[model samples]
Target: MGKVVVVGDRYTVSLFKLIGTEGLVLDDPLNLETTLIKLKKREDIDLILVANDLYNPVKEKVESLVIEQKKPLVTVIPTPFSQGQPLDVKGLILRALGFG
Candidate 1:
């Protein structure tokens, strides 16, 4: 079985850590490409949950890799505890349970 990895800010990484998921805190945008490349080489990582804030900066490159390689599926996720449009917890649960 493969693992799920989170690449984002300290807060984003920390949250995943609580659930025992491995993550990387990437503070510099300039190093984003390098970080992605390194993660791509890791065979144990099957899914990458990239924080939306960081993903937005390198959207093109990330999208291309996801579309072309199709390994280690990449997804953009909202920052945990971020202030924005409120999340629909109930709806999310329903969807997860295949009820929505």
Candidate 2:
């Protein structure tokens, strides 16, 4: 029903944008908190894809929003430099269902 968005570093943003994903590329980590807070308030955003590296720094804040607001599903995704790993689809489902 709502739009999906991505928030990450320049490389991550560029890669997703190439595939036609809409998002914001954060140039500075200092602004990550404020940027995420703003995105959380948007009624049009149904999901948010955050780079794993970036998400680690703001995990607490992000998780709190995910649990409390329960909208705009926030997910941490692997970055280009990370080793290949299988996605935990089951875990994500549980989290989305408020069971994780």
lDDT of each: 0.72, 0.71
Best by TM-score: 1
Candidate 1 positional error at 54, Å: 0.5
**Candidate 2 residue runs with Cα over 4 Å from true position:** 86-100
How many clashes in candidate 2?
Answer: 0
Tens-place lDDT digits, model 2, residues 1-100? 5766778888877876765567798866557678778988999877777777777776776667545656777777887765778555446434644568
Q: Which residue pairs collide in model 2, if any? A: none
* Consecutive 10-residue window with the lowest summed lDDT within model 2: 88-97
In angstroms, the error of model 2 at 98 is 16
lDDT of 1: 0.72
Looking at model 1, the pairs that clash are: none
| CA RMSD, predictions in order | 4.1, 4.7
In candidate 1, what residue range of length 10 has the lowest lDDT sum? 89-98
lDDT of model 1 at residue 79?
A: 83
Residue-by-residue lDDT tens digits, candidate 1, 77-97: 778556577655345334533
Tell me the TM-score of each prediction against the true structure: 0.75, 0.72
